[model samples]
Target: MLVYVVDHNGQPLMPTTRGAFVRIALKEGRAKVTRTKPFTIQLLYETTSFTQPLSGGTDPGRTNIGEAVLDAGGEVLYNAHITTRNEEIPDLMAERKAHRQASRRGERKVRQRRAIKNGTITFPLEKERTPRGCEKPIVNKYIRNSEARFVNRKRPANWLTPTTNQLVETHLNAVKDICRLLPVSDWILEINRFAFMRMEDGSILGADFQNGRLKGYPSVNAYIFALQGGCCACCGKPLIEHYHHIVPRHLGGSDGPENIAGLCNECHGKVHTGKLSLDKLGKAKKYAALSVLNQAIPFIYDGLVELFGQEHVHICFGWQTSEQRKRLGLGKTHDADAVCIASLGNGSQPRQIPEPYEIKQFRRHNRAIINNQRERTYKLGKETVAKNRKPRFEQRGHSLESFLKSLSPVWRLDACQVMEVSKSTRYYNSEGRCMPGTVFYRCRRKTPGFIHGDIRRQGPSYGIMPFVCLHIILMQASRRGVMPT
Candidate 1:
């Protein structure tokens, strides 16, 4: 691994691979560690600011982003793959909205009770009327206690969805980090702009481009019925009464024809009950990635041009990237594609291929504090009881014998107990050896005290690990490209 360096004034200099030099500099108090993940250092004395021209490349994707930096000699200086949390955002948002709605409903119930006691409710209650067979009940306006504000809520011209915003931010943050770590002069970004109609069918031309799959059809249900040969996709029956969503609506799936399929009532019920799978019926075409990329790419390009000048920022298409990658005989990975993007039109083949840093992004902190956290319950003396249930067992495991000497402490206690533990993952070096770091452990101590005993094969280790701690430490680096030391 190479150690990135910066001057005494905190300006990024070329990174060095010599371990001995860095070690001696640190030993003599001439340098200090700045970042732990990438192992960067900063000089404590004055140094020359002269540097060679370098170029960088970025390959943006829906969930993952690849970045690389190359020196003037075509030597690969740094490369990393970032796995974003785009896939989990929709579910998280749904959970948050659910919690908020529940809290509001509880507050409204309290208000209703108070109003009844105060004789403030003079109006008669009325039942809401909803459409026949609709699952959602139409709520009365008075009982709703809130006016419809969706019409008043206006979105800005540059507004983006939570999913797309997270993706765009991930790409921008990765680029900003690399630019601050190296002296990159120019950047090449590979972004794919897909033709949705052409991708679905290659024969679309002229007037057909304007006419979509549902052009002649009266409705989406009719189109799907015709597409599936007017038969149930699951049982191949002629009775097609229901339109099933191949991808469920809860997970941000759209109502597009590609995601909807014709199904009978029996098959639809079976699908909802998990007896049938979507793949068994027919493979559903997903355009989620395409849609996100189309909206996020323009914002990403504009952001890059604003940060690094318009002249330095360049855009490359997927076809050109594919041609170059094929010519270079590189594998089809985000990192390999990034290398090809960097060396595009420059004929700069990498001297040696190195394992790129695998970085996974996580939310800094959870926002919902009162959400439905799983309650730990265990059989205590033939009766199930919650761990947090209270008149309270606060004694240590060692001292538990004084309370009941006939049975062992483990036998007297339940199998599961609530305890605060750090979330951790194993980190490995390029040599395929695991690096020393904190691991996950369950504490048996009912009260706050030193934990002793085996932690599920992790061995007897003691420490007060915090809940949801940040294991990966980030370094504070300059956000601007190259600055004078």
Candidate 2:
């Protein structure tokens, strides 16, 4: 294992593989541990800034990032496969949106009740006026009818979706963090620009730009209907309207013309319910991964240039990386691709093939204070009757009574996920023996409660064990150097 080192002034120097030297320095109070998981130390005494020229190579990806630092002589210094949080962002954003909407509705309800009490409005649904030419009457004058502010909104030239932006940020932050650890003078990034149109049809000429896949067709459904000869694929029923997917959207299916099959309503329902099958419908075209990669590549390259300077940062295409990796007899992986990217200009093979660092990026801070554990008692066509329940006791063998009995006088139930607080990080060696430096407490909670880092000694006294707090050393250890405060 390589130990990254820094000077007395906290500036990063060359990393050392000498474990005994590092141990001696620590024992003699010459250096102190700065970070773990790519273990780093800062020296107490001043040191010279002389260092070897190191170049970094990164395989930019939507979900996983490959990072590697190499010396001038093709020596792999620092290598890591960083798992990004891009996939989780969308779901979290959707949940946040739902929460915000619910909060706004609750606030509006409270305001309406207050207005009714103060005689500002008679009742919650009391109508004040109706706009001309509008069929629906305007109810509740107290309810604010805000103007369309979205019309005046302006986006910058380089604007990306939240997920893509987060992904790009992850790449940038990963590079920045690595730079802080090692002296990276230049960077080589592996990127790909997909020609989606060419991939679909190689025969497509320049004139085909004017005429798209759905040029004459009004909609995709209409196009599919025409493609299927206006009849159901399973049953030859005329006047087919419903569009059936050969492969479901959830199962990596695209809504392209090839993936779509025209079917009657009954046939569509039958296909969905597995009562019937359409063998004529070929296959589903999946371009989601490719599309995401294509969209993110430019942004990632631009960010790299801005960080490492235009002269220092060099771009290598995906094909070059693949060719080199194949010639080097390396297996296809993110880390291997990164190594290939680094060894591009140099003819010699990488000498130092150390075990690469495996680093997974964590979600910075969870904004969710409460786990909305709602169980639906009854579900009709459009209505669902749900009862709010404690998140922890929902599982078998966990109960509120047991939790209450275990709780101390100082302890109170706060809204948070029980799993997070109870989670303990225990590192193990290659022989599967548990090592030291476990961060969170292994406090197994009987019932769900909030995760407050402030509960230091409260867990042990009550036999619950110390729970992992979010704002404590956990955040610093995990999410450091990613986002600025």
Candidate 3:
């Protein structure tokens, strides 16, 4: 553990070992405790006006990030791992997409039903182009009568998915905050590479290699047939064969022989189209490790340069750091990788390895519910806010009672089924859209009367279906909606 320090002016300074140094300062009224979470102190009296050239290193990751800040003397000042919250981003995005699609469809239906101007939607369905004398389906009545949008497949040149953009922002934010507090004039980030070229024929790949192996063809695709010992990589067939990229090209697999495999014509097409399995081709994922770290190059690199200035930012490869770690006999961990990375920035400085300070990024644990909500429309939007603010317990006693009491007594009807049809046709439009109908209910709960409109299936008409049957259904969809007269 270390004690964080600040100058008399409340400006951040280098941290000191939590021993006689900090104890003496506190005992002599030289410093006062400012924060207790990380045990930081603020100097009450004037202190040193100088700061050391601190170097920082980061092991950027998808789920968690490892960070370390070291002083010019190679002494560790701060180190900690951070857990990121991108897991729910995808689920939230899917929900948003569903909401947008529903809204668009509702708007489109309303416009068509009212014969209003066709706007808002990007691709309005158009009528079929007919010959001069040929007839086309009637618009609105028989079809949407809108035109199919032809040009809707373009995006801004420089664009990243919403999730990807957020991730990049999170990483950059962490680096910026560290630089502000520490006298960090230098930074190092360890990035991985997809170096299929370095692999040789019959050599196994790391588990992070998505498609496992390329059979026995090596990594070069230029002479795949020649490298396979004049035989098919699969089935040991001496007959003519076709080459295939173990992983599809669009999915990051390159044309190198290491990513190439030999198969018969039939097998080749199947593999390309995903009809044949790689296991059937005798390729195996007998490598150690579940995933390979993806190095975000130009994306993270350019941003770091822009933020820290190019002279301050330094980038290193995985192999270089691994070699360094091996020479130092360090364990394989994010912190160890970061140490090697910081060592590069430390240069020839020969000082004791600074004790790592495990710092984790945490603004708030988990997430606030508001992070998952968006602007809903009308009543739904209001209800959502209320639920988040103060959740109301739904009393089931009068929920369906309100809706049931609004139903008319079907004693006058001859058949129960006719009562069902009348209830529907009278209260709903031909398209089965609910229409307002009169509803008056007096329940013991006096739950404020509401004229709710909903499409009801016919068989459960009031005075037709048994009370118990109706009770069961209302329990399932107990929405306190009554029809407006």
Best by TM-score: 1
**lDDT tens string, model 3, 403-464?**
33444766322322332211111121234322222122222223432222232444333332
Candidate 1 on 236-313: residue-level lDDT in tens? 999898898787667555687877888899989998898988854333436778888898999999888988899988
Ten contiguous residues minimizing lDDT sum, candidate 2: 415-424
- Candidate 3: list runs displaced more than 4 Å: 8-11, 18-37, 42-48, 110-157, 195-295, 348-485
Give the clash count for model 3: 24
TM-score of 2: 0.64
lDDT comparison, 2 vs 3, better candidate: 2
Model 1 spans with C-alpha error above 4 angstroms: 127-138, 141-144, 216-247, 251-254, 258-285, 345-347, 369-485
Select the stronger candidate by lDDT from 1 and 2.
Answer: 1
Across residues 106-133, which tens digit of lDDT does each residue of candidate 2 receive?
Answer: 5677787787778776444555554554
Full-model lDDT for every candidate: 0.72, 0.71, 0.58
Clashing pairs in 1: none
Local error of candidate 3 at residue 273 (angstroms): 24
Give candidates' CA RMSD values in order: 13.2, 13.0, 17.9
Per-prediction TM-score to the true structure, in the order listed:
0.68, 0.64, 0.50
Candidate 2 deviant stretches above 4 angstroms? 105-144, 202-210, 216-285, 345-348, 368-485
RMSD of 1: 13.2
